[model samples]
Target chain A: MLEISGLVSGYGRISILHGIDLRVEKGELVALVGVNGAGKTTLMKTIAGLIRPTAGRIAFEGSEIAGEGAERAVAAGIALVPEGRMVFPRMTVWENLMLGGVHPRARPYREATLERIFDLFPRLAERRDQKAATMSGGEQQMLVIGRGLMAQPKLLILDEPSLGLSPLLVQETYGALRKLNADGLTILLAEQNVKLSLAVSNRGYVIENGKIVLTGASSDLARDPATRKAYLGRL
Target chain B: MSAEVLLQATVQGLQMGAIYALIALSMTLIFSVGGLLNFAHGDFMALAMYGALALYQSFALDAYAAAPLLFFGFFLLGFLMFRRLVQPVLAAGVLAGAQLTLGLVFVQENFLLMVFGGDYLSVPTVLSNKNLVIPPLTMPWPLLVGSLLAVVLAAILYVVLMRTDFGRQVRAITQNSDAAALMGIRIDRVQAIAFGIGIGLLGLTGAIIVAQFTLTPAMGLDFTLIALIVMVIGGLGSFAGSMIAGAIIGVSESLGSLLYGGTVGAMIPYAILVLVLLFRPHGLMGEH
Candidate 1:
C-alpha cells in the first residue's frame, strides 16, 4: 500500500513533476497512463526515492519515504523496474537477480524468490548464465521484471512495461503483469499504451504536465469523454 | 662482465618489476572503481612510507611486522579522503579529482618535510647486507623477499575481487554506477571501500620499498610518474594491462641501461609508451 500527496520532483533546477497525488491499494494493480513527458516516470521515480522531491508526502504502509534514498526504499519493500529496462549490462542474468535481492531483509529469502522468478520467466532460467546486455529486448524486459520480483517487494512499480517491444511481447508482458497481480502483488503500472493498461488495471489515473488530470475506475475512465478524446484518440 | 654479473642484473630487474607491478595495479584499481586518474597515488604510497617510519621509530617494529597495521590505518585515511574530498570533486570530472589529489600530494609531501626534514631514511633490515649466490646470479635475500610478497599480495587481491559478493557489487558499480544503485547497491559505500583498497595496496608497496630502497618525501613524485606511465601503457582501467606494462617497463629499463647509457636506459619506458600509444590509443588492453 502506497499513498502520495502533492509530490514535486525533477532534475537539478528544473521541475518535471509539479504537484501530483496518487495511491495504490494493497494487492491491486493501478495504472497511471499518459503521453510521453507526462510525468508518469517522474512520479514512479519519486515514489521509488530515486529523486529528491521538492515537496511531497509519500507514505508506504504508514512510514514516510519521500526523501529516503533508493537503497532504503528497497530495504523498506519497494522495488522499481525503471524505464529503459536498465539491467546491469555486464552482469549475468542470475547475478542481476541476485543483486536485486541484496537488502538485509530480502537476503534470507533470496534463493526461494529466485526460484519463483525463474519459474515466472522460464526463458531466463535457460539463459541465466548469459550476460543481460546480450539478450534481445523482449528477453531483457522479462529479466528486468524478474529481477524486480527477486527483491520480494511488497510494492513493485513497473515503468513503461511495454516500451520498445513488439505487439506480441507487449501482450506477453501485460499477461505477466495480470498473473502477478492475480497472485496478490501490489503494482503501480505506468504506461503510454492506454488501452492495454486500462484493460488490465482495476483503477486508473491520467497524468499530464506533471499533474494528475483525472482519476477513476478503469472501466469508467476508459469510456469518459475527456479521457477518450485526449488518450484514446476517439472523437 | 662475468656471467654472474649478468644474472645479478636479471634478478634485480625482476625484483624491481614486481614492485612496479604492485604500484601500477593500485593506480589501475582506483581508476576502474572510481573512474578517476588518481594522480596522488604515489603520494599515498609516500604517506604510508612516512606512517610506517613513524611507527617504526616509536615502536621499533620491523617493516614486515608493521604491515597489517599500516594497511588498516591507510585504508581508513583513504576512505575519509574519498568521502570528504574526492567524491565531491568527482562530479566535476576525473580532472578535478586528479587536481585535488595532486594538491593533496604537495600538501602531504610538505607536511612530511616539515616533520622529518629532507634527509633520506632507511629501514635497517636483517637481510640488508646478505646475499645468496647461485652458479650465475648473486641474488640478494631482501629483493627475493620483496618480490615474493608482491606476488602474494597480487594473488590475494585477485581472489578477493573475483570470489565475493562485495566484488560483484564493486564490478557492477565499476561498469555502471546508476544501474548498480537502482539494484540496491550503496555506490558511495562501495566506492569508499574501493578507495580504501586502492590505498591499502599502495601501503603494501611502501612497506616493500623500505626493504630495498631508501625513502624520502621528494621520492613520491618520481614514483607517481612511473606508476602513471605503467597505467597509461597497460591501459587506463585494465589490471592485466598494468601488470604486464609494469614488468615490460622494468625489464626494458634494465636492458636499456646495459646496452646504452644510464639516462637513455631510463628513458626507454617513456619511449616505448609513445610507441604503444601510437598503436593503441586507449591502451594496449583498454576498452574503448
Candidate 2:
C-alpha cells in the first residue's frame, strides 16, 4: 500500500526523474521495468528516501513520507535492497544481517529473523563470520535479500535483483521472490529483466527516460506486440 | 650502549608515546565516525588543562583530584560542541566540518590567550619530582602513571568497541553511516556521545600535562599536529593501529632527543611521517 504522485528527483542540477506517478496495493508484487539510465533506480531511491524529492507526495500506508531520510522509511516499514548488492563489503555476513535488525522494533526478533534467514539461505549460515565481499555474487544477492527480510519490512523494493546473476541464479532468485510475495509480503521489483519481472509480478509498469510509458496487467503486457518488440527484443 | 642508558631512554620514550596514544585515540574516534579531522581537538585538550588550572586556583585541588570533574566537564563540552559546531555543517560536507572545527580552534586559542595571558605555565602534580628506583633504572612517577593510564585507557577502549552492542553500532557508523542510520541508530545522538567521549578522554591527558609538564595557549596546535601524525602512522580508521603507532612515536622521539637535541627531536615525528607517507601513504595499517 503505497502512493506516489508527480515525484521529481535528481542528483545536483541534473534531473534524472521527471514528474512520475505510481502506486502499489497491499500484498501486491508490482514490477517497474526500464532500460539502463531509464530512471528506474532513481524512482526507487526517491521512494526509499535515499534521494530527497524536489516534488513528490509519497504516501506509505496513508502516511506522508515524502523527503524523509532512509532511516525513517525503514522505520515506516519500507526497505530498499539497492542495486548492485550494496552490502557492506568489510562487514561479516552475520554483521550485515544484524545491521538490518538494528531498529528497536526489529531488535527483539533478531534471533528469530536470523534463524529464518539462515534457513532460507543456508550458504550464509555456513559463512556467518566470513566477510560479505568474499561471498559469490549469487550468495551476496541472497545475503542482501535476507538482510532486507531481517527488517521484517511490509514493502521490500528491490532494484535489479537479477543484474549480474546467471540465468539459473536469476530463476532461482525470482522463485524465492515469488515465494516471498505468496507469503503476503508486498514487493516493488525494479529491473531490466522484463520477462522475469512480468512473469512473476501480477502488474507491471514500463518506463523510459524518467517517464512511465506503459502500465497494465503483466500478462496482457507480456502478450503486447510493442512491449515485446521494445523490451523483450522481439521483432 | 649501556643497559641503564638504553633502559632510561626506552622508558621515557614509552611514556611519551602513551600520552600521544591517548590524544591519538580521540582523534581516530571522531575522525572515523564523525568524518571530520577535528582541528579543534587540541583546543579541547587545552580547555581540560585550563579547567584544571581554574580548579587549582579556586579550590586549591590537585590535578588528579580534579580529574573526575574535568572528565564530566569535557564530556558536556564535547556534546555541546558537536551540537553547535559539527551538526550544522555535517550536511554541507566534510570540508565544511573541517573548516568549522578549525575556526573553533582559533576562537578557543584567542580566548585562552585573553584569559591566561601569553605566558607559559608549568603544572606540578602530586607525582611531580617523585621517582621510582629499580636497580639501574629510576623513572619519574608522573611519566610512569601517565603511561599506565594510557595503556589502561587503550584496553578499556578496545573492550568497549569489541565487546558491546554500542561498539557494534560505532563500527557500523565507521564503515557506513547511511546503513547505520537505516538500522535505527540515531546518528546524531550516537555521534554526539562519541564526540563527548573522545573529548572526555582528553581530561586524563590534560591532567598529565598540568601535573607533569607545561603549557601555553598557542601549544594546542602542536598536539593536534601530533595526533594527526599518530593517526596517519596508525592508519586513519584503525584503533589498535593508532595506539601502537603512538608508542612507536614516543620511543622514536626519545631516540631523536638522544641522537640530536631536544628541539630537533621534537621535529622527528614530522620528518618520520613524511618518510612513511612517501612509501605507505595509507599508513602502516590504513584501510585505503
Candidate 3:
C-alpha cells in the first residue's frame, strides 16, 4: 500500500538518499535494515513527510504523498513512531496516547482504539496518570508504538524502535510488532538490528549508504552469502 | 509587620502578581506551543490598551463588553502576525524568529506614539476610582477586579488545557510539535491558534491594566520585563510555576515597598529573579 521511487532527499547542501526505490504491500511487515548512519532514519522521515524530499515520488495507495506536510501525511493514513521515542515527557502516559488520536478521523474510534492499546500494554494502563518522562526506556518505546496506533494509521512507520532497548526488551518489542502484523496491520520498520529485524519481517531490504542494496523474502535474504556476511555477521 | 499591614501588603501583592501571571502565562503558552519567544508580547498588551480605548470611545462598552472585543481582536492580529512576520523568520531558526519579534516592539511603540503621542494617559473605565473599604485597608476597584479576573481566567484556562480535545491538541503541540503532526495535528493550525491565545491573553491583560494603571507608549517595556522575569521564575513553560513565581515577585515587591522605599520595591522583583536563577535555575516549579 506504499511505494517510493527515485526518492532523493537530504539536509541542506548534502543529499543522503539518492534515487532509493521501496515498496510495501497490504498486511505485510517490511523491514529496512542497515548499519549505523546508513540513512535509515532519513528515509523513514522522508516517507512520513517530516523532511521534504528534494526530488522523487512517495505514493500511498497510488496517490503521490511526496512533499506533503507531516500532518497531511498522518491524515493520509501514515503514522510514524519517530526515533528516540518522542513522548510528551511532561504529559501523563494517557495524555500522550490521547494526543495520538487527537486527529478528526481518529477521534470517532478513539475510545475503542484506546481500549485496544491499553489491552496491548497493560503496563501503560497501570501508569496512566504518571508522567511519561518518568517511564523506563522500554516502556517509552512501547508508549511510542501505542501512541502511533492511536492515530489509527493504515501504514505505521517506526524508525529504530529497538535502538537502545535491552536484549530482552528488544525481543518483547519485536514480538509485539509481530502480533500487530498478524492482526492485519501494515508496518514499515527501519533498524540497525539486522538479525532480529530479518527474523521478524516477511520481506527485508539491506541498505548501504543511501540506497537499497538487496531485497527478497526474509528467509532468502537471511541465507544469501552477501547478506549473511555483510549484515548477519556470519562469514 | 503588623497583621493588618501584612494583610494589606499581601492583598496588594496578589493583585499585582495576577497581572504579571496573565502576561507570563501568555508568554509561556506561546513558548510551549510554537517554540517561539514573542518579544512583542507586551507590545500586544499595549495594543490592547489602545484597542480598549478606541472601543470605549466608539461604543462606551464596559469591562464585560470590552474583554471579548480585546480578546478576539488580538487573537486575529496574532494569527496574522504569525503567518506574515513570524513564519518566514521561523525557517531561519529560533533566534531569527526572536529577533524579528524583538524588532516589532519598537515598531509598535513608535506607532502608538505617533497616534496617541508620548503623554501618559489614564484610562477612564466605568470602575474608575472605585474601591472597597474594610477598616484600615481599601481595595481599589481595578486591582480587585483585575486579580479576580486573572484567577478566574486562569482557572478556565487550566480546565481547557486539562480537559478539552482542542486543549489536548494544543498541549500536544506544546510538548512536541513534530510528534503532534505525526498524530495528524496540523502544526501550522495549532501554532496559529496557540500564538493567538498567547497574544490574546497579553491583550486582555492590557484591558485589566487600563482598569488599574495610566498608559503611555513606553509602558510596554515594563510589562514585557515583568512577564519575562515571571516566566523565568515560573520555569519556562509551567503554568503553575508562572502563578507562584508571579506571587513571589508581587509580594516581594509590595513588602519591599513597605520596608525600604518605592525605588527599592521596584528593584525587588529583579533581585528575586536573579536569586531564583542562581539557586533554582529550573525555576521555582519548572519541569526541565
Candidate 4:
C-alpha cells in the first residue's frame, strides 16, 4: 500500500538518509531495523511528511506524498506513531484518540475505528479519561499505537514502539501488534528490537549510517552472517 | 473622594476591568497557542477599530450591526497572516516569532497611517452616555453595554475551548504540537483557526473600546503592554488567570488613583506584574 523509493532526508543541511528504498503491500507488515542512528526514524518521518525530503518519492495508494506535511500524510491514509511515544501528555487518552480520528482520512470510519482500537486495547477504554502522561510507559506506547489506529490508516508506521519498555511489556506490545497485522492493517515497523521486529515483519531492511546495507526476506536477513554479527549478536 | 464618587470609581473600574479581560484573553490565546508574545496583538485590535470606523463612515452601519462582520473579517486576517507569515518565523524560534510580530506591528501601524492619515475616529454609540444615577452608584451606558458583551463572550469562549472538538484539538496543540500532529490533529490548520479566533475576540474588544474610549494607532503598544501585564500576572496560557488578573489590575489601578494619582495608578499594573513574577513566575494559574 505504500512505497518509498530512494528516500533522502535530514535536518537542514545535515543529510541523514542518503538513498533508501522500502515498501509495504496492503495487509503486510514490513520491518526496517537499524542500530542507533540508523536513520530508520528519519525514513518513517519523511514518509509521514514530518520532515521534507531533499530527494525521494513516497507513493501511498498510488499517489506521491513525499514532501507533504504531516496533516496531509494523515489525510492520505498514512499515520506515524512517532518515536518516543509522543502522546499529548496533558490530554486524556480518549482525547488523544479522538484527535487521531480528526483527520479527514479517518472521518468516515471514526466510530468503527474507535471500537476497533478499544477492542484491541481494552486497557485504553478503562483509562480513557486519564491523562496520557500519567500512564505507564507500556500503556503510553499502546495509547500511541491505538491513536494511530484511530486514524484508520491504510499503512501504520510505528517508530520504536518497544523502546524503554521491559522485556515482558515488549512481548505484550508485539503480541498486540501481531493481532493488528493479522486483522489486516499494513504496517511499517521501525525498531532496534531486531528479533521481535524480524519475527513479525514479512520483509526486512537492515539500515546503518543512513543507508540500507541489506534487504531480504525476514528469515534470510535474520540468519545472514552480517545481520547475525551486527544486529542479532549471534556471532 | 466622597462615597458617591468612590462608588462611581468602583463601577468604572469594573467596566474597565471587563475590557481588560477581553484584551488579555485574546493575548493569552495567541501567546499560548502561537507560542509568540505577539506585540502586534493590540495593532490587530486597532485594525478592527479602523475597520469599524470605515464601515460606519461608508455604509453607516451602526456599531452593533458592524460587529459580526468585523469579528469575522479580522479573524480571517489573523488566520491568513498567521499561516502565511507568523508560522514560518515561529518554526525558527520564539525570539524570531516575536521579531516577526513586532515587524508586523510596524507595518500595520504605518498602513493605518497611510490610509487613515493618523486621525482618531470613534464608532457611533447607539445610545447617549447618559448616567443612571443611583445616589451612591452611577453607571454609564457604554460601560454597562461593554461589560455585558465581555461577560457573554467569555462564557461562550469557555464552552468553545472546554466543551467542543475543535477546542480539544487546540488544547492538544497548545500542550504539545508534535504529539498533536502525530495524532492527526493538523497543527497548521489548528493554529490558523486559533489565531483567527483570538483576533476575532480582539475585534469585539476593539468595538467595545471605540464605544467608550478614543482610539489611535500609537496607543496599540501602550494597550498591548497593559494586556501583557494582565496575561503574565494571570499566567501564560491560563484563561482563568487572564480573567482574574484583569479584574485585579483594574482594581489596583482604581485604588492607586484614589490613593496617589493617575500616573501611580497606571504604574501599579507593571509594579504588580513584577511582584507577581518575583513570587510565582508561571502566573497565578499558569502551568510550569
**Which of 1 and 2 is the better model by TM-score?**
1
Which of candidates 1 and 3 is the stronger one according to DockQ? 3
Interface RMSD, every prediction, one decimal place: 1.3, 1.9, 1.0, 1.4
Q: Indicate the docking level reached by candidate 1.
A: medium
lDDT of 4 by residue, A108-201 (tens): 7878888888888899999989999899999999998988888888888899999999999899899998998898888889989899899988
lDDT of each: 0.84, 0.85, 0.87, 0.84
TM-score per candidate = 0.94, 0.93, 0.95, 0.92
Ranked by TM-score, top first: 3, 1, 2, 4
The TM-score between candidate 4 and the true structure equals: 0.92
Q: List the residue pairs that clash in candidate 2.
A: none
Error of 1 at A81 (Å): 0.8
Measured by lDDT, the strongest candidate is: 3
- Backbone collision count in every prediction? 0, 0, 1, 0
Writing each residue's lDDT as its tens digit, candidate 1 over A19-113 gives: 88888999889999999999888888878878889997899999999889888788888989999998888779988888887766688988999
Q: Pick the candidate with the highest DockQ.
A: 3
Q: Write the residue-wise lDDT of candidate 3 on A1-235 in tens digits.
A: 9999999998986889988999999999999998888899999988988889999999999998998878778888999999999998888988899888888888888889999989888889999999999999999999999999999999999899998999999988898899899999999999888888888999998999999999999889888989888978841
Better of 3 and 4 by DockQ: 3
Candidate 4's C-alpha runs over 4 A off are B1-7, B88-93, B103-122, B133-135, B184-186
Native-referenced DockQ of model 4: 0.56
DockQ for each of the predicted structures, in order?
Answer: 0.58, 0.48, 0.79, 0.56
Model 1: lDDT of residue B122: 77
Error of 4 at A74 (Å): 1.6
